[model samples]
Target: MDGLYEQFRIALHQVWQRRWLAMAVAWCVAFAGWVAIALLPNSYEAKAKLFVAFDNMVPTAAAASQNPQNDIMRLKQTLTSNENLTRVVRRTDLNKLVTSDAALGGVVAGLRQRIAVVAQPDSLFEITATSSFAGLSNAENARTSAAIVQQLVELVTSGQLAGDPQRTQQSLTFLDEELRRREQQLQEAEQRRMEFEQRYMGMLPGTGTVADRMAAARTELAQLEQTIVAARSAVNAMRGQLAATPATVPIPGAENAYAGTASGQLAGLEVQLSQYLGRGFTEQHPDVISLRSQIARLGPQAAQERSRGSAAGNGIPNPSHVSLRAMMSEREAQLAAAESRRAQLQADLAQLGQRDSAQPGAAAEQARLTRDYDVLRQQYDRLLADREQLRLRSDMQTQASAMVVRVVEAPRAPSGPTSPNRPLFLTIVLVLAIGAGIAAAFLKGQLQTTFPTANRLASVTGLPVLGAVGEVVGRAERTRRRQRLVWLVGSGGALAASYAALMAAEMLQRGPVA
Candidate 1:
């Protein structure tokens, strides 16, 4: 410890002997460092806070599970995107300053680097922008910083207000068009279903499984058979009533020599004679001659009796017999219709019974068509539902009921520059300059190849040093030493003047420290 102290003392004495050289080195290093620090541009940062709110107005289950932080992060990315940066540049004075398009890209990149985004809890965020300090005035730097931050806020807010709404409206229009297209498709599908049903008719698998369809067909067939039986019974009853009634009535002034005194007997014979005549019997033939003689004989007697105004009228037809004949005709027509219906029912039942025996290929094709129709129907329904949801979402967005962003704290002009701490820079420069000067002195001493102290000399020579010799001051040597001193002083003065001039020029061109 004593030896280290002694060595330190000796080195201090050597440094003191060359104090002028040490001072020159220190001054040079310090001035250079000071110039470098002074030339560094100052940077000013401005910050503002923003608050985002998630409205979740659409009332969807997914909305509850949605992460607001993800939205915030996405917004941050959008704010810093190249396109947004370009827009910001165009809106600000950057456009005028950067004339070349190629150079503008670099400027935008640098601007991006100067921006800082900090996400906070509760959907709060902070946006910061930094720029090189402008003019000498602190107000100018503050104004620049504030302007940048304000522009950023405007960009974000304007994008939210204008872009988001327009995008939502566009989406709504697209959805509306899609819904129309889907409706058209649904109509076409419905038409296809109708055609298919018409083509297959009772063969379709309607409302139930194959077994159920067969059961329904069988039940309908049985009902039709019962209806046919009832129709036949009604026809038979009408026929019996018609058989008991007379076919015709006696005509007035007709002869009665052909049969009994009953006018109906004479009417019946006349009807038979007419039938024979209608069968192509000539009037001169025996049958026709006999019928004609009979009619001529009965005509007078019947007319005389009719003129007597007898209580029993024989020329008029029986109303009951006429009614029974009409009923019989109606029953026959009904029986025909019922038989037709029964035949159709039988055919349908046969088809249902043979469904399993039908061609496998046809059955598979029918199933495929039915499945396709069902799928299309389901798809149409789903699209209809989605269209409604999209419409609701669009309305909510239009009303600004969804996610919202607002400036929580407006940006203000800074009171001072945030970067290029003048005092701190000067302190670092001083320390570095001192260190450089000390190193230079040691290097100069080493280049001399001579012992700087007695301790060093003793260690090198392995000898004991009794004393140190002092150089004799000759006249010429004294003059040379004086000249060297003057030169050193002049050089140091010139260096100081140069440094001061450079600093003054820099202050004039760039701004003074804010």
Candidate 2:
């Protein structure tokens, strides 16, 4: 512990002995550092916030614009593009430095790096511009930063400038031409379809192809056959019924009965029974069974009185038999009509078979042509719709200036430098200067052969050393030491005062920016 303390004391004494050289070194370092700091141009920042609503900018039918990520990215890229930056440069103080194309390119490149556009949630955007052009004054750089942000805002707000005018116009023209071509092609395709229908498919039933019509015809023939068989069975049943019915009714219960009647009422009763049967009534119907019973009851009576019939001596003609015969004839007529339909259907089937042999691929060709026509129609409609939307969009952009960006906060130049942190940098340089000075003095002490103490001297020499004598300061020597001390204090105070003055100047320099 004592050895460490003694070493520390020796270092302190050595540094004190070369204090003037240390002060001189510190002055040199501080001067260079402060001057370098002063040479750094101030970077002024300008910022603005915008509400970017995309709903009104693009049509809802535009599929690519469903997500806003692409739009935001495009906006960011466009704001920093070289053309916009060139315009910004021309409109600001940076225009003075752009003497040629190369100069403009350099300026634009630097400006692009300094500008930042960030998208926030809820369709918000923040645009920032930092200007630190070495060629311009600090205040001018601040003005240029604000101007840059303002120019970008203008670019975004201008409907015509939001997108390329020439490209939009070209797209509209191209779509118009394409739509016209599609219309012509559609007309030609429709004409071909009509001609095909008239020439090839005209003989087929309905609008179906040959095979479809043939299948439909066969199905109809099968159903018609069932109807014909049912009608034939009904006709046969009606024929049997008519043959079983007698053409006369016997006179009932009396001699000299009328020739046209059984007791002059048998024919009327028979007619009523036939009417019941014709109304789709069953044999189980009460009236029909009752009439049959009455007729059977009168049969014996009429046979007993047959010799006593009228002069005509013929039983009344049964209207029931006539009704049954008429029904049978009507059923036969219906069956004949059904047979005629069946023959016509068979002939159609034969004709379809022959057509199939003649043109085997007619159905497939028709289907393909119809499919192509439908697809073309759909595509043409889609193009027409898109062209209309594009035209409206273009008109809105040109005449109405529909695309709008609302500025929530307008861009303004900063009142102070955003970079360099002058106060902190000055402090750091001061500390570094003092540290360097102390290091220099310590290094000088280390290089010298002299030792500050007996212990240190012995340690290095490896021998016992005699005690050293203290130097006696006379009055003249003390006076000269005081003068040197004064000079050192003055130099140190001058450096400190320079730092304070620089700090004060930085504070005062903000007035112009504000």
Candidate 3:
């Protein structure tokens, strides 16, 4: 510890002996540092405060429950977007100053680097822009910063700016069109479902398992059996009535009456021909031609039958037999139709039984169809609900009843440059210059092998020094030393003068301080 202290003392003494050289080195370093600082452009910063209030005229439960932090973040991103930056550039002199496309891009990129957005307490946000250009005047720097902030404010306030209210409206319109298209799709789906139900009828997979379908089919079959029984009873009753009536009823002019009706038959044929013509069938159609020929043949036959009836002088046979035959024919047709319906019901019942026997296959198919129908139905319903919610949101937006951005503090021009902090920079440069000077002095001392102190001499020679010699200066030597001091002083003054001139030139170029 004592040795370290002694070494430190010796180093201090050596530094003191060459103090002028140290001072000169320090001065040169400090001058260079100050000149570099002067050459640096001034940076001016402008700041604005924004109080983001989530104000809405008609606040919904959803909107009110939203996180304001997320909205604030989104707002920050919007302000920093390239589109907003381009607007800021256009509003200032940057647009004209930038020449080519690449230069403009570089300018925009540099501007983005100078901007900062910070969220403070109490829902307030701060936007700061720093403007600095090579050889820029203090007033120009301040003006640029102010312009950038002003353009940012305009972008935030104007809804027509890109990715703001215009985007919101476009999204709403797109959703509206999508909703309409979905509605059309839903209507078409419903139509298809109704048609399918009509075509399949009872066979449709409706609200039950296969067992339920089987039970329904059995019930339908029972009902059809009862209808068949009723129809058979009616047929039997009609047969009994025919059986009770005589097969032939005596009528004085029955035969002649039947023969005389030929004229009415010919009139019926003419009516049939007219009906075919009205049905859009041409006369060349097989059915139309056949009807015409039948009418032509019937006309002559009717005339002959009428003449024979007139010559015989007999009234037409009793019309009761004709009436009985027509009644029997109608009953037989009804019985046949009823039997056919019963057979169809029986066939449907058999199909249901077969499907029940093949339970796995039938059940899988039924499940698949049911699942598909249910999925589509659910999707349709969900889309309907979403459309309703979208409509409410779109209405809210259209009415300007949603959260909005409002500026609490407007931007103003800065009074002075915020950067290059000349005092602090100069202080740091002075410290570093002193340190460098000390290092250079120690380095110069180390290069010489001669002992700088008595302790170093003793340590190297292993001998105790009792005395030290002091050189006495001659007259000529003294004059030479004095002349050398004058030369150094003159050189220092010249350096000082040059530094001052450089400072003056820089100050003149920067213009008067604002």
Q: lDDT of each structure?
A: 0.68, 0.80, 0.69
Of 1 and 3, the candidate ranking higher by lDDT = 3
lDDT of 2 at 512: 79
Worst ten in a row by lDDT for model 2? 57-66
Predicted candidate 2: what Cα RMSD to the true structure?
11.7
lDDT computed for candidate 3? 0.69
Among these predictions, the greatest lDDT belongs to: 2
> Which residue pairs come into collision in candidate 3?
253-315, 253-316, 253-317, 254-316, 254-317, 254-318, 255-317, 256-316, 257-315, 257-316
Query: Candidate order by lDDT, highest to lowest?
Result: 2, 3, 1
Candidate 1 lDDT tens digits, 1-514: 9988987876676665665777778788878888777777767788999988877655666343345776576677767877777877777555655769887898789889988889998889999988772333445555667777898888777654234455556777886777788778778776766675554455633454344565666676677688878988888877755644555454566434324553445456576776776688887899878877876787677666556744144356668788888888887887788778667767775775565466435445556667776877787788777766666545554463566679999998765567766656666766676667667776676666767667688899999999988779999999998898887678657755655565565445344433
Task: Estimate TM-scores for all models.
Answer: 0.47, 0.54, 0.52
For candidate 2, give the lDDT of residue 461: 89
Residues 392-494, candidate 2: write the lDDT tens digits.
6556544543334799999998889999889889999998998899899999999998878888788888999878899999999999999999999999999
Clashing pairs in 2: none
